[model samples]
Target: MDTCTSFKGYGRVDELEEAAFKRKTRNQKIILSISLVLFLVLIIGVVAGTLVHRKNNNNADEVPAAAINSAEAVKSVCSVTLYPDSCLTSLSASNTTDPEKIFQFSLLVVMNSLEMVSSTFPKKFINRADDPEVKEALKVCETVLHDAVDSLDDCISSIDGNQISISKITDLRTWLSTVITDQETCFDALEEVNAALVTEVRHLMKNSTEFASNSLAIVSKFLKTVEENNIPIHRRLLEAKHGSPSWLTAAHRRILQVGKPKPNVTVANDGSGDVRTINEAVGRIQNKSERIFVIYVKAGEYVENVVLSKYQWNVMIYGDGKAATVISGRRSNGTGYATFVTATFVAMGRGFMARDISFKNDAGPQNNQAVAFRSGSDKSIFYRCSFEAFQDTLYAHSNRQFYRECDVTGTVDFIFGNSASVFQDCKILPRQPLPNQFVTITAQGKTDPNQNTGISIQRCEMSPLDNLTASTFLGRPWKNFSTTVILQTNIGGFLNPLGWLQWQASDPPSTISYGEYANAGPGSNTSRRVQWAGYKPSLTAAEASKFNVESFIQGTSWLNGTNVAFDST
Candidate 1:
């Protein structure tokens, strides 16, 4: 009985020990939960504080603010440089009066460089951008730059000022720099988010030097103009420089000097230091300069084609004489349609002047179409020149031009164009190949009534080259309202009794204005000529003055050195 009681007591002791152990474990678990919760709360507070501090610091970084400020400053500078009429007035108030031209000359350099950058670098960069927004923004910036340049061009063309200061030009330079800088900043803001943006930004930076160099060159030219204007004799001398005894040949030689002439530039046929092929000499000239380049050619047959780029200006090509020196091209209709009309000499450069040079497309009658000279230049002049061809010859494409003392020969409508041109003292030769092959002088003109484009032949001579004779007309209207005039000219017997040809049976007579003023020759019998509604044989002196060289060629500024007589009668 005693042993059984001891066993019960032990069991009770074991149960109480197990219960105490369980209680200790519960207390430990509760303490662990409370400590873990407190640690988590502290971690959350620290993380939130860090985030807020970073946000504040980012906002305080005022580089973005400064960029905006700089942009505004740039805008202000541009307004001062271009917007204020007072600046133009102040510059013109001085004794010198060619600020507008000087500014234009300087700005052309900047524009040309910018064009190169925009065409080359910007295209590559835009295609490589990954972010849509960033790419669009860059495109927008480029567009803005282009638009700004165009606006600047317009402003320069219209601005009437003389002698702009270097400081004022510097302001423009700053504005252009700011435009590039701002674009760079935009790229930077996007770069971290968009890794691809680096290419565009890098391109901008790389090309910025070229842009800056162009700007610097422009500023330098402006300064030079101002300094030149300050010198009284220098300005007058430049304005009043007279033509030399061999002015016609000298002018062309000067034009060829614009390019880097070959080291061994040999005039193959002459003792009078002059080039043979103008193109060979043109290789030596620099782009975008105001200096006049003259190329002289001695009497010889130069079988080559020549092209004058738009960048080349104040260029002149002269020969020993039209009869002696011939620039000839043999490409004809057999040489593809393009080659058929390929000119022996193409004058595309603005302010291009040539004299005493016989430009010939020597492609014979069997060759079909051949162009001797093609000119699409504004303010262009061809004095004492000759254009010889069998088919299509003179391709006067666009702009206002003057050809005085020239001999032009062709079978078809040789002088074809959509430009305002006046041919004075020019010999018009019509070569007849077949009996019915009618000689048409002009084919195209201003289709729009608003456009001022037409051909005015003043004091010209019309003659036949071959024994074969056919009815020749003044011109056939290629486009609507084809305007042509034959004023005080000697019309050859080869001219058809009818003055003009009707391309189609029912041409808009109102559209074309084919007229003649006191034309004298065997073919100038007005009584037997075409009784077309548009033909007017008699004209007053005031009416004929419109076709004069001075008015048509804008010769007041460019003809300063020339002594050519104007066809006033």
Candidate 2:
């Protein structure tokens, strides 16, 4: 108390100390408040960061591992295609890892794109076309594009939810290949009529064609993977060792196997049968009939154009003989008809069979690009038939076709098309050509390397129908990857020393897969054959077998029911 009371002039010493203490307590409170505010800020930051991390983890977990894996797998699948970028972009939206599903998506993408093209094509070009030829070609494009769309529809239906059966794949490849052919046919028609429009039309259809090509590649890869991995699939559609197609009922097989099955309908010029013309017989057929409808075309010269449309299925038409029963027409490209529409007998139905029949286009060499027998028939068989014309005699137009003991006679491109066709023990007779026009035996139109299409003349005879002053060639590559293999066949001496010819005057394209294996006769000599990059003068036996019936068309699976003789090896 005495120390506190000392030397207090302005104020008491106790009061001064108490005032200093109050000021110090105020400063401490301010410091405490600042620290509390900082701690609260730190807590809020830590909580926010933790919530963000948890949310990020949750978002990643929402994407299943399978989806990530599938996306990667899709990338891998698309990587091997010719149009990888297109393939990837098309399949980007697909979310499944199943290869089959991926393949189905590819097909759907192609289908949608094609449908768009088909719809817009007519609207874009057909109405504006001025030339009659151009207009006709556009119309033809419209038809073929529609047909292509239908084939794609069939393909999608075949694989929508079903396991990829061997038969289903075969059908799919055939139809898809046909779609490619249809696309090219449009171009070919346009090229013939108005070359100026080709570039534009092709530009318009570029996406569709590329998508189709990618789908084909993916399908082929899928098949290869399934086969290599020994994956079990529905094999019921696979060919039995000695039986017909599994879809054929016992009664149908019996009827097909018979030497002279009773006819469901008949055609005769002299009123011996039910109908007088082949068109009438075709008209009576049930649309898309599962059962084989038999038509007995008796002996007569029927001067008519017969078309078995795609809606008509499994039709078997037989005649007395090639000479006795003749269906003749005179349509030709020179007569203002497109080469495709100039066909005398057009077969567009699947499983179409003709026995002992004759199809003729009387439009001679003057009528360029006349087609006698145009077959878009899948798994079709022509036995003991004859196709006679000046140009494009046997238009093996598309799909899997087999010719056994038939006669195909023409001057230029006698046997031509994009079908995976095999001719066994048939006569490829090259008649006289127009002045300065050399003869080309085959013009395989394999526009894409992935297309499983070619002309396989196996165990056949290629000779001149008459004295040939003009030179002859085994084939000319019509498209980039045109494939024509003349294997184990006889060639006449009239063929030029050069086994093959160029499609144009330029150097032959190296992309063509032309081969001659174990072929006999003078024209088969490879010493003077064109030394193109793609021409294989002498193919090994192993390579030659790839063009056989079993390997080429998978014929064993479907040919058994037809009762037609074929060499599987």
Candidate 3:
């Protein structure tokens, strides 16, 4: 009986194996058949799309084969972007098929949409809202939308017809990125004011933002193609022993390095310099000057708001020391001021540089959202400066900014903005917040993935000012695609082991890119960091290199002129 059972079991096993083999063969055949069908369908769809595109153009006979290929290329480029439909719609009216021309057309669409939004936003929402605060926020929206339009105009002007250089692309990306930030900032202000028309305003602005995003995507694809093909073009990568900006000439570098450069204008509270106040010195500036217009402020506490207007270009302001020369204000959102207007020092001009100065907003933590220093200046540099406040201490608001050996202190979102900013050899201090308020170090606002903007905190130190702190985190995402990296920094023990916090009760979207590489100190431990989909506790050297000065901000080309120290690697 045992022998008969063993034989029967062997027979059954053989039969089961034969059945499994047959099923595997049948599945493979089905997969092959489906794959072949899908391939045929894809070919048919491409051919049909091309034919339809030709018919829409109305003159297929006049259209060259290159034009046909160009049409297909446009479809291919749009296919890979996040909003293919929007991209196609924006490019549909373009008569030229050149990728560069298509990108230009996309920018034109963005500019037109933004212009429409700028014109319609005020009429649609400002009068509808009865609250003064809401109206103020709406006004802020109008201002930013106008700024966006102006930036787009500048971008369009910079492009020499259809030809766009890599450097030009870089600048275009920066400007477009700011456009996205400006739109989101409007929404943020409206949300803060609790405007009832916030949703409507957002809806009105959605298409413009989407068009801008598509333009960014299209340009990025163009850039990638250029690089991959090794197409020779006008490219400038500034290489110098020390760091500087494009406009910083060798003479300027010498003066800055010598540390005793003669000032074009001077400011002092006492009757010792050319002017009694910084603003007075600013007023004397030659609008859009190409040379470095130097202003030396003697050591004193100037309790006045200083603004470097957009018309003032290549202005360099330095002081005796961060501790001795102080600019202080008390503007805060709690005091009915919009966050955009709350900065004690507002730098809006291009090539604005400040060294050894202290910007302070003394509104206290109770006032909420006080900004000490706000920079919208492109290619701006802050060296050995200090920003002090209880919240939003340093608003690196927009553009390419670099901060070296600076000190920033705040209770919440101390270092925040949408700029492609890097902080090297700086100190980030978090002060005690109001009861039950948590401390967050950085809140980077990168609304679009192609923005080429992020907060790269390299070789910095993060420590708390007061003891017995509540939960502290590295940062919370201010936008969906916010990007930040803490590389080779020293974190204090006060930071929560989780290392990062969500923006609200729910976890931030997976688009937020938070990375920490080769950080030291107790808080740098990744064993218990937040398990969010986008949080990267450990990154390899190659991955971290992308956030460095050279790759991140194209710093090598521009920093050679600033005479500031930077690490390209």
**Candidate scoring better on TM-score of 1 and 3:** 3
TM-score attained by model 1: 0.54
Locate the minimum summed-lDDT window of 10 residues in model 1. 1-10
RMSD of each: 34.8, 28.0, 17.0
lDDT of 2 by residue, 495-531 (tens): 8998788988886677888898878887788898898
Candidate 2: 10-residue stretch with minimal lDDT:
1-10
**86-138 per-residue lDDT for model 3 (tens digits):** 88777777756455676778888998899998998775778787888988898
Tell me the tens digit of each residue's lDDT in model 1 across 338-371.
4313678876555687767799987786776678
Q: What is the lDDT of residue 228 in candidate 1?
A: 37
lDDT of each: 0.55, 0.77, 0.77
Which whole-number lDDT from 0 to 100 does residue 507 have in model 3? 92
Model 3 weakest 10-residue run by lDDT = 1-10
Flag clash pairs in model 2: none
In candidate 3 the C-alpha lDDT for residue 118 amounts to: 96
For candidate 3, the lDDT comes to 0.77
Candidate that beats the other on lDDT, 1 or 2, i.e. the better one: 2
